[model samples]
Target chain A: MSGASLAIPDRLRLLRGANNEGVLAVVLLALIVAMSIANPAFFTLPTAFSILRSSIVPLIFALGVLMVIISGGIDVSFAAIAVFAAYTTVRALQSGTPDLGLIGAFALALLIGASLGVINGFLIAKFRLPTLIVTLGTQGIFKGALLTYVGSRYIADLPASMAQVSTTNLFEVSTPTGSAYLHILVVPAVLLAIGLAWVLRSTMFGRSIYAIGGDVEAARRAGIRVMRTQVAVYVIAGTMAAAGGMIYVIMGRSASPQILVGSELDIIAAVVLGGASIFGGRGSVLGTTLGVILVQVIYNSLILAGVPSAWQRTAVGVLLIIGVGIQAVASRRSSRASVIDETYQKQEVPA
Target chain B: MKLADPETKPLSRLNDSVDAGWTRLLGLGRIEGGVRRMLILVVVAFAVFAALKPSIFLSGTNLRNIALNSPEIGVIAIAMMLAMLTGGIDLSLVAMANLSAITMSTMFTAVAAGDPALAEQLFPVILLAGIAVGVLGGVINGLLISGLGITPILATLGSMQIYNGIAVAWTGGKTLYGSPSALTAIGSSTVAGIPILFYVFVLVAVAIGVVVTRTPLGLRIQLQGANPTAARYSGIASRKILLSTYVLTGLLSGIAGVLFIARNPTASADYGASYVLLVIVIAVLGGTNPNGGFATVLGVVLATLTLQIVSSGFTAMRLSAYQYAIAQGLILVAAMAFEQVRWRRRRRSRKPAVQPG
Candidate 1:
């Protein structure tokens, strides 16, 4: 009875809740605390920096995917796009007379990502073809192109400046145990995450993405150019995935078709685990960051605990099931709330 | 909205009759929306194949090759069509097929250990083992999706990983060789100017066709898939229907696995991974709408032939392996575009017919 009379301010705050990001923050804190207690070495700066380095590339792509999902679509070609981008960049460097050099290569790769994303958007939004079908076809095309372009030959030697990004670390940070560690190339990833979160929260375009996803037809009727917004979303996603791919090449020191063969599933799962709906509209970049961390943590913990690497796939499989299950439950609750709302509204109307 | 205006009613009726007649003649009325497209694709494909490879296209040997290659996929396609028809997908079919292949191959190698001739004689035994493994896999998928409230796509996806993992683990990532001769004979031997496996595929397809067209069970499944909420409200058990379809698909895929083992005489971790996309493509191309309540088995069979010819043509032409991916993608795009064109045409013609009244 008292809840029904709640203040508008309190209700709005409740409706636009802190969401899955808050859950992620709690999970991150709990993970750090538990891991630290289990192994004091876990809290050391070196270990932390190493984890950060490992997380950078995936984290970047995950942000891009988070944007796509929030805009109510999916891009399964992220890994493929990244592979192509890396291939292009490496092929550029190998010719000695580097066309775009490092910065130019990355910019071109991002442009390709965005362009391919636009193609995906055109097929899905304009043609009214199912997203799954178009993406599946595009994925095949991307993979095929990668295979044909590289033809099993990997570029081993790269320009020193480009290769040095992975190994270069900042000054050492002192730890409680009198130990010190350096930050690796992942230094940029952390900065990128913070910047992305800021833009997503404060920008007008970011708000439009949420609005479009939440109610596409309504948004369109309200004079929002749905097609353009969706196309822009895919372009951004493509660019980010391209950036992630480059980072991956830097870390791994080579680009292989098999490197991230089944990685798209992991990216999607991470986004879903972070509580993003496959149906679109509601999600957070912070939540996705945690989702990636959760996945990595699970993988890392399993390795540290001496579990076989094969079981890592099983862990992902199980996590996917659990993630979908939670989403299903959440969907049911939201629908039930709508039903209750309708009933209340009908009662408020004149007989 | 009144479809009975005097000025248009007679012409509309005539148009409806012609549409119905045309669809029935092509076997489109026997299933759902996609089946008609598949039928059209088959015509387009056969004409193209015959034109491109005239000498070999009409030859008995090539026709027999098409037959032999089909059963392994054909049976599985039947199950897959049912699953897709119900508004769900079974990504695990290929994985299940691999598992069954491994199981059968393992059983063959075990029973005939150091006795190749004896293993050759026990072909039926291997086939039974493959079918059994497939049924078991299907049961697991059905139970998980139906009994556990898991969505078909996610459930099957999870099962895909699990099945593949089990297959890999069971074989310890090693290929199983020295399969039974009887199974191989079923794959290779010709009977009455046709391949044995082809007959088996025909029988399976016809059996499934009959079940889908004539049985109450099939009717309930179609109803359930067409609208789960409506079906559930009408007292149909949607969960059971879904579970049974998954089971059916798994069982058929298992049969396909055995045929694959029989033909290849080997099983590996990578045995069925490639088939996953191909299977979906063929099923969709065959005229089985994943969200529709009906499918055309014959259309799928014809489309399979067309696709196989295209694949063989590509290989024969010495194209890069990557080209096959491009071809498949293009074909899928074309099929979808064709469906959209037909849908638009139907919508356009119907609007004018209604508006004039």
Candidate 2:
């Protein structure tokens, strides 16, 4: 090959190594601009707030899954966990028991989610089974149990306080078309993302997660409690899934048995789009947050563009493939570069 | 050069040991092991179902119904077995099947609407087109996975959505009817009291089993899944093997789709959505290794029958449809967990023995 032609792969490899998030951001910006151009109303403040509000639950889920994925595992059953948690909490609230405060309800939901996560973690870590398959089985069991016990009822009769919490806004801004309000849950969602980002960046446990994901045997040799860390990762993922479900119920004013079923694809696509490698050991809360936003924006924009909602799943699927394709190409190039570097260093060392 | 060769010898030996360890850990070469376990489960399920509702569960008509229903999911499960044997999964099988059925049914309906006699003559052509849709779907999946290097799960997941979306868009989520008599006969008609669909399932399963076990291509697939790097070094075309496995799955799925429409006499974009999980469950329960390298077609066939019995048994016992999902999930988890335990025990027992020469 000519020198100039060879330089093209090198340049592409360089781009892949360093600019994954940068590329995603560019794509997001282009999509926003395109949507704004197609529908002038898209860039309005109200629509922006609406998109953010809608993104909160999925963002929560994406953050959880991002961590799990980075730790070399996948959790498809989070949707089921969310359903079970949401259903139980909604049922308890609707049963007219002595008012357990909002905290109690949140605790109940989180506890259930974490417990389910523990079961998943234990099975996967102990049995050394594939995470995808384990979670796939659990996903079915959880949904089936819910259906059997709960009978597919929609729990719309939430406590007055919980319903009020949904409408309770932190701030309201008037726009040309309408006013927009940031709901109360938005603060917690943002805080969770920030807290998780901090933990992933700063904590010893978080570093161990990355280490294990990068090379499990190495991590084990280095005395990282691989099993414990894995269980913790699933627990965190489960908790976030539960939190997302609760948010969905509170903000949407209804909890149904079917809530979040088959929505794992959206959550996963968002994380992957945000620059998380499905193979693990790479991802961030910030990237996942942006990914969630980009996905929601695309989804909302599609509806605004009058594309039927059925096509949205197709769009997400395409996005997933593209995102994964980019990651695969980048990682392959980087590995190849390192291999070449190792060979070059060996040659120079003998001289 | 002699010194370097000596240095590399130990490393190669270590690699060989690691390979052996994995095969032994998963009991990969023990094809008969899964078959025996599945056979026991099938017998137990039959006994339990018969005990619960002898009149309905053991009835000739109910037995025939189970046989009829088993093929649709069984055929897909066989396809899934091939995919899993190569250490990949095709989540798009159900979607491909539905899309193919929809395409075939739509074409048939349009033709019949225009000229009933001509539609009758072209019925076989329409069925072939449906099978073609499945093959096309498979080829697309194979390219995305083998060519682009996307993981099987993500690649098929995307294809599943795309294929399903196309079906939905084409049908506007409406069910299409009017299958030709000949097409329906393939599903509903029987020879010597045995359903035609069962024969098709058996034929596909046996053909695949023979190809995978008795042929060089099958050996290549096993080697590729067992150790891809070694397989590559040994001159196996990894991409070609992967591509062919997915294409074969797609073809099987297409056949299943055609049979699906043949039996139901209607095609819907969303048909057999639930079978996605069911087929995976069947494949896994049948002892196909999710991590690849080892699979038994007979195991899958037995597992399919076992599941069909449990399903119709539940109906006989008047259990809610929700119970069926619960049982399926439980059985899948239990089977996998049992396999893991058995493998671990075998590994532990083998560890104490002297290394084989």
Candidate 3:
């Protein structure tokens, strides 16, 4: 943010953009070093792969959350969207089209997820209602509808496509403790992250999202379709959440409606940790990826460090507060300049 | 859609603040249009359900059951309303309540040691300790938001995790029994077919009603939520008021904790996970604004009762528990959407969206 005023070179400005990632990487490294000194088992290849495997689910979910946050809205209903889309898709495939295969499964999941995303998008963009409230209501409705209309029972009998992915590990290593297997989904997750960074950095839709977050009226005045862009952002979030759910099912070889609905807070914490502003306007894929990994590490490693696993909740809360607090304070400190600009712009308007 | 907002006219907003301030100084609370609407909804719901199942829905046992379940959620809804009145919310209230209840429940076991005689004497002190836990938890949330400028939702979200963690860790993920017999008796006892616990909820609601409408703190909260900038310009200490608002929420949660343990034999971390949705629904249905600055206690109370009836009716009607979530979510969404309709109509007509009787 300070780079805006400085006579910094282009490369240096890019480095400034990576400041959040840099800090997170440092914290993560320090934590890893400390954990290694405390328990040698923590820094092993097996542990690394285990953490990586677990991260795929939250990372996908976090990417979508990162999108909504950048557009300056919150979606607490992603968990509901995830389970609702995934479980319904599984049930749909199992009932009739088991032959649709993996591609069909993903296509079906994305469609279902996107359709639901349309609800959030429509309500938010059309009514201009607060995103948090809309999502909270939908969270209940989606989860309830899933249990009421669809079956609440877990389905372990997955389609050949989903079950096959679970077994399609890139590599498995046998350690004294257990075998560590990296899932095939990790590559896609990385690809998605890179693709998202490109889109958010270079695409008009992505820049419009940032503009909307920064100032909706200003964006509208600048010929950015604010409402339409807001709707699209939520749609993207929904589709991503659905993809996350399918990935989760593919990894576990099961579709359980109840297992993933409560994990939104942790994912949100990770997203915020990665440098996305909760109030909106700015975020990065790299920062979010680091955040997801770091949060997952804290959640998984606390128990290894002799702290009770239950304190993972506390860790998430603390990380979220610290992460949000840093940005909030910095923004507040720099708000004076924006206040002057706002007045200057106001004077130009024909009110 | 954006142009429909009434907030565009600064001159009108100035009149609103000045008018509300004068009304508040006179100690006469402004009756928001939402309270009337919620009251109507409550009546309509009760009438519809009663007409549908006259024998079962209006039965003494069913009525008592509804009353029994109303207090815990009602108390939490009030906490949520106070936060909403400031355009903030306390998601951590439930976690804080659980922590408080667990604190008391475990302490009861420690002090009583299976002796009912000693349990009676130690109950009051132990209960105070539980409330103190909630108060302390609220203090942490207050300090985080009002002191450090964290957003209320994120701040409470964090506090919720921390509080829930402590409760879960302290309970070791197990349900602990042995609350004081006095609490159990109060929980189980009834007054004219209504649970004594329901009266406690009513008492809390009424007390809060007075505090919010009559007290200087209440006026400050209204002003702060209405416009933080205006409040600050008027010399109202925004931080202090925000701190007290959360603290009040905490106190309500603490009291709620006592009632929770009184009703149940045990306290655990995961109790009432569903209440999060129901509580928010009640607060919103009660006409509590999500943007802060407006709420009504009686409206929240009515909403709680209305939901309790809907829940009990669901059981009587042989519906699944999950359906209630849909009903609640639909109710909230419908209410918000209804607000939008009225707002648009009023904006289009350039007049208050008055409904004819």
Candidate 4:
């Protein structure tokens, strides 16, 4: 599998292989070029940084969704988990728990998220209830509970550590037009992505994830611990969601219980558009990253491209349907079979 | 609660089609286990609420409000349940309802052109337009899923976004207030002490339920969901069934849309955004198998009543809607959990004998 052991043509072939990343890369490049032609400011370093800045939380959340999707399940409750966990931590800190440093607060958020995710895993793995229904139910339950029992108001004043962290900059550039700033916030998102990519690519646990997603019964037959893998998948998903929520709050220097209330479909759409299948068993971190960037660019730069924001949702939806429609047709061509046969075959080959 | 009461004229007179359909479903003697359980839950919820607030909870006005509020969610739930019955879900039905409602409301607004009196006269045309939009939306969903081979979830999710976006763009994300006066009258008025829309809902639900249990299309839908491979070998056209499944659900949405604009008097892109999950909860609580192939009309009907009572009971006790939301979630998870545990125990009990053998 090492690149060093392969010939030049083999390396090229590998680079141009079965993933959606290559197609996504080309589309992203074309969009960027088009946007630049439409508006010169769109190509600037400042614009790039701003796009990168705005996409941070969504990128984090998309990774979690990508994992869950690859594991043959879906998680709509991540948004709920994210806000609930982050809000709980922020509320506890606001309610007079002495400075439990930023690390402490983060750990608490992750812990709360993991515990909540355990509930999802338990119901799903033990009961085999449909993931969509379970998550949907919990989404309401988590948000409803937070608003009723916990505080619903925004906390603009945070603990000193969180307050200071929001202002910390990794670097900044001055220009005649607009300044380009890279906040320290980029580090965590980058680190988390790298860590997740490595775990998903190199670890046995990662392989188990792919296995289970490909076929749960087959994975069990092949000696993988399907239940344990599934539980861990949800836990990791919850923790990442919590991280996304915390990132969102810290970036804005304010925490609200209602943050990210209805953003699940958007994130899931991004994951699927990245070449992940809703039926499960195939996705790549690289594809997801590009998918996030593609969706973010379209969403952020529509105005620059001379489109009104009112049409943004329509644009995204059309693009998604067109994108997935192509994949569906291509798969059908490869196997002349009925609907049931098609679904069954997809789980087997995963491409 | 006058839910089953016949204070007005005979219910059969409302829709002849529904009356014919009823003959097919009413003859079944075996009660599904899930339906029986759901009925118990409904009765329990009703009894508890009636006992707690005998004065106001069971009052005619409050009971009337429950019946009035029930149809919108109830009709939409039927659509959701039908989709799930075929092993798919239409996440866009809520959006479909909105789009169709918008189409209907826009017609009323455009035709009337400030003549509220004239808008009242174009009722039948406007109602048909609303349902037509729903059918159009469903056709698109069907094409994507069955024609293009896209999975139903992705297909519906994408369509939901598109439909919702179009509605938002058209209305600039604001409420386009103005339904036909006739529709508004239907929404607000009661006939012989019962809401007219309630009659529509019951008629529609019973008609569809009968068709689901009695017709070839209904049996084929269940067969496909129950075992797609077997259905395929049996020469059932999965594509046609899937398409018809969505189309039928769409037709229901159109009906719900007419009811929606009538009830709300305004059409908007983002109305009832929260109802998606609640609809799914209702469908599942009614014993619609999320994995597909099995569902019950009586069960779903009772489950809707149960939740409405529980939600209305919270109001009567001065409790917040959020608490009721939590209860909705708990009821679902707890029910599934109990089902899972009982099955696990049964399987465990059988394991010892198999090991010895």
Candidate 5:
């Protein structure tokens, strides 16, 4: 082959690696312009802030799920935990406990989330049960707990601080149509995302998760505390879910059984669409954030275009299929090429 | 391990020859044979239900109702068992059932609108549509999983959304109901004081059992599931086998869809959503290995009956539907947990290793 042609695969590999974030950044920009075209009202700071605000729960979920998925175990019950946390938070606020105030309630919920996660980790690591079955089992348990605690009763009339932080706006930003307000909640949410990204990219513990996902036995043999890492991953996942749950309760001003119904799938889809491997070993928090934004943009654009609510699931479902299909195809090609390269190298060796 | 004893083999062989021997008459040695534990659990469940609610559980009418109401779920569970036996899962089974049922219902509606008198004549069309929808879904699953080499669970998950979304979008979120009388009769009408669907499940179970035990295709499929590398090295086209397994699963799911719609007579978007877990539970309980390639069709059928009886018995005893749902979920968790413990115990008993190998 010619030198240029021989470099094609190398170029393709480089493009695959480096072009993911760039492509997503471009997609986000395009979506903003397209959404604005559909409704000039969509270009306002209020709409942007609202989208960012709406994104926080899923973003938190995505961050936690990223670590678990990278560590080679999935927590499908995170969504259920979110519902339970939100319900508990709302009830605590409603009951007006003096000892367990808002901060105490939040901390208590986080502890519950961590405990549940640890329980999940213990079951999987100790019993060696398949992650899918274990998670499915615990999902039922948590759902049962939520039902027992909430009893079909929703807690309303949140404390003023919680309500204000959830709904109040920062200074307005000018738009083509009109100036609009930005929410204060996005500030903390962004800070949380940034902090998570730092932990994932810079911490040794985070690196261990990636290593474990790559090869569990190898990591174990290399002196990594595999069980401890797994437990930590699940605990963080749970904590993030609880955080998201409380934020969701504050924003929605209510808690219901169906609050987070079937949301785990969406969170997973976001993670995968963001280029996180389902098989684990690799994922990026930055990419996950963009993935969340992409999903919101798609959702918001559909509404702005007045495509009708019934068609929304269908559209998103189609997008999921297409996105997964592309990933499948790309991975297949890379693996095939790698196999070929291995064979060629083997043949060249002194056998 | 005791069941696989070398000493018992000689006695077991002798008992097989002495057809009317005292040991055989006592049902003593048979407990050592295929899926005896499952059979015992099922028998105990039946006895308890019969004793607790004799008026409801053991009655012919109630039995028939239980059989009729659950056959579709049972049928799909059998399909799930087959896929699981091949060391893979078809998460799209529920979605496939939904799509197939919707297709059949939609087709029936189309035919009835053309000629109201031709309503009964469209039964075959509905059946064909159901099977066709299932096959198409299976093909997509097989192509992605086998051809493209995607992991079965993830691949089937993607297929689930695509299949279900199409069904919903095709119908515009509307339920297609009031199907032809003949179509509904498949579920509603009884033959010889038994629901037709029960017989259908029995035949399916027998057919699958025979195929798995007696046919090369079935043998190869299981082999591929049990040990893919070895099967491929032995000159078996493992991919083709995997593909066929998914297609068969899809076909059975389609049949289930037709039966499900007939029983309900209302094909909503949620037609098969709640059945996914129930199907898995029945399949796993029946003797299918959730991880891969080991199952008994007979075990699945029996487990389906036992579970259906328990749920129906609960309903008969004035328990609310939510209670039944909760009980079902708990039983499912218990069953899976029990299986996991059994598996770990067995593994622990095997040759111990110091490392991952």
Candidate 6:
């Protein structure tokens, strides 16, 4: 096994190790400076805080998708899952369920999301279906169910307590230009990112995710519980999506069945841009966070630059192509280098 | 060899017997098993619908409605089948269609406004140009996938967005209407009470079927998809094959778009956003292997009719459109699952019958 691993060229390994985050950091810094120079107001604390605040929902979704990508699968149904979970919570609150406070609503959302995840997990793990096709089906089913059961109506009559929970400011800073506030949701979002990052770095389950993604047959031979790990990854994704949904409803003070329809692309683009490979086995919490921030910054700067909103989709599409193109080239080069190294090592061993 | 051992022989024979029983129960051996199952399903759905709405379901107008509605989807579904046959998918099909339709219709509207006589003469040109634009879209996708090495899904996904954006920007998100009567006739007119659109679909389907079964290009595509490394080592140009498949898909989808505007006489950037998933369902339901290398034009045709019947049935039954979506999703999942199970069973059955080493 050790000899097999040594087939990878050291230079390629080193480059892969530093690739995504380093490029992103430089690009992010350049964009920030450029934006600030173009519009001095963009550099202000209030603007920065607003950008951070708007990123919370997508950040949560991105973290979940990052885990899915790292585990060698993809889930576009998370947005639908989030919508279902949020609608359930709002409907529960609107029903005037006594003692079903914000915490209870949140718990309910998580439970519903987890159950849906379990269905996705069972089908993909047991039957060995492609995650993309399976999720595409489930996305339709979930969205259809939402439409049939909940209609297209928005839920606005939420408990005042829920609104307060979302609006509760963690801290505020007053500057000469203006004041900036941080919502309470940011704390949980940051903590979740940090905790997941730690898990990926230090835990056996986390290591197994990488192994499985790197090579399923090898991972199985190494005694990794592939099915269990896959299910766990999806469940975690579902739970996180639910949390994101809760935050969305709280922030907006309403829930619509159509919420987050077609926004999964944005989440996926952010994760891919941050350094995560869609093929799996490569990603990090830190990289994903930066990806989320970078996507937000690009979106913000485009708006500030007075570009049409429709062009924003074009920009995101272009960014996705470029980012994925670079990753593909890098991976291809690395794989080719490894092949050459393997042959060279074999020749040297005989000599 | 393991077969020389008397003790192992009984176990192997018993395993074979059990596998044979399961395979028999599942109807797993035949290549046409999927078609048989789909035919049965179609029969059952037709019977149920006919029973519920005896007058309307069996009426000529309703039948024509099904015929008219299915070809647009049928044309695109065939293209989707081609893409899937190459072990790639074109998520940008609908986007390509809309973009090309917008371009053609926009050109038509402008030309007609300035010179109606020129517009009449250029109608065919405009239609051809729309299809050419679709081919251009496919060229872009082929370049992205084969030239740049992006995965088909991601490549097409990105292109889907880009094409959609361009369409939106081009028309400012407005609908382009009023194509010439000659153009509309291709979509709406019928000879001897049969829709020309249906005839076009059948003709295209038969042509594609013949080409796929008989032509060298089709053979190369099948070979590339079945095993690209083997195909490449055998001197086939895998990249060129892939590029051609996508281009073919774009051409078909472009034709579908033209027909769409011919019938509706309107082209919009946002038109047929829902068809993306629906076409995938139809292709998969038709037994075009999602992983590629195996497809049937006949299967696609049958599947289109089956779905069209169900859709029209649902409409006559007054069920909501969401119900149709639900049915499509369920059908896609069930069809794929059935294929997976059949594959696994076939693999298992093949194992024991192999000569022991």
Weakest lDDT window of 10 consecutive positions for candidate 2 chain A: A13-22
Better structure of 4 and 5 per TM-score:
4
Candidate 3 displacement at residue B279 in angstroms = 1.6
Once fitted onto the true fold, the runs of candidate 5 whose alpha carbons sit more than 4 angstroms away are A1-19, A26-47, A99-101, A159-161, A174-176, A347-351, B1-34, B53-62, B316-330, B347-357
Q: How well does candidate 6 score on lDDT at residue B190?
A: 83
lDDT of 4 by residue, A1-351 (tens): 888999998887676545667878889999999988888888888888888888889999999999999999999999999999999999999888997999999999999999989988987897888798789888888988999998789888888888898888889998777788988888888898898889989999998988888899999999999999999999999999999999888888898987898989999999999998787888988888888899889987887767778888788889899989989897887666667687888889966
Ten-residue region with minimum lDDT total, candidate 5 chain A? A13-22
User: What DockQ does candidate 4 score?
Assistant: 0.68
Worst 10-residue lDDT window, candidate 4 chain B = B7-16
The alpha-carbon lDDT assigned to residue B329 of candidate 5 equals: 55
i-RMS for every candidate (Å) is: 2.0, 1.5, 1.3, 1.2, 2.7, 1.4
lDDT of 2 by residue, A22-106 (tens): 6777788899999999899999988888888988888888888888899988888999999899888888777767667788888
lDDT tens digits by residue: candidate 5, B50-90: 88889877888888788787678788888888889888888
lDDT (Cα, tens digit) per residue for candidate 4, span B1-357: 658558344654666657766765675655787888898898898899899998889999889888988898888898898889988898999999999999988888887886767778878888998999999999999989899988888889899999999999899999988887777888889999999989988998899899899999999999988999999999999999999999988898888888888888998999999877888999999989887899987777777878888988889888888889889999988777776677789999999989965
lDDT of 1 by residue, A1-351 (tens): 376798987766555445556656666678788887887767677666666666788788888888888887766778877887777767766667555656776777778777777877777777667666767777778778778765557777666756776666676776676645454656667777887777677887787788887888888888888888877777777778788888788878776665664677668877877877766788887788888888787777666667666666667677777666655666667889999999999999976
**Which wins on lDDT, candidate 1 or candidate 3?**
3
Best by lDDT: 4
State the DockQ of every prediction.
Answer: 0.38, 0.46, 0.57, 0.68, 0.38, 0.46
lDDT of 3 by residue, B164-264 (tens): 88888888899998888888999999888778998898899899999998999999999999999999999999999999999999998999899889999
lDDT of 4 at B120: 80
Residue-wise lDDT of candidate 3 within A1-351, one digit each (tens)?
A: 465675557655465465367778888899899999989989888899989988998998999999999999989899999999999989999888656888888898999899899999998898888888889899989999999998988898898867888889888888888888887899889988998889899999989998998888889999999888988888889999999999988888889889687777778878877888777898899999988899878877897888988788888888888877886687777697799999999999976
Q: In candidate 2, which residue pairs clash?
A: none
Higher-scoring candidate on TM-score, 1 or 2: 2
Instruction: For model 5, give the RMSD to the true fold.
Output: 5.8
Docking class of 3: medium
**Residue-by-residue lDDT tens digits, candidate 2, B302-323:** 9999999999999999987778
Candidate 6 regions exceeding 4 Å error are A1-19, B1-31, B355-357
Q: How does residue A190 of candidate 6 score in lDDT?
A: 94
| TM-score of each candidate structure, all chains considered together | 0.85, 0.91, 0.90, 0.91, 0.87, 0.90
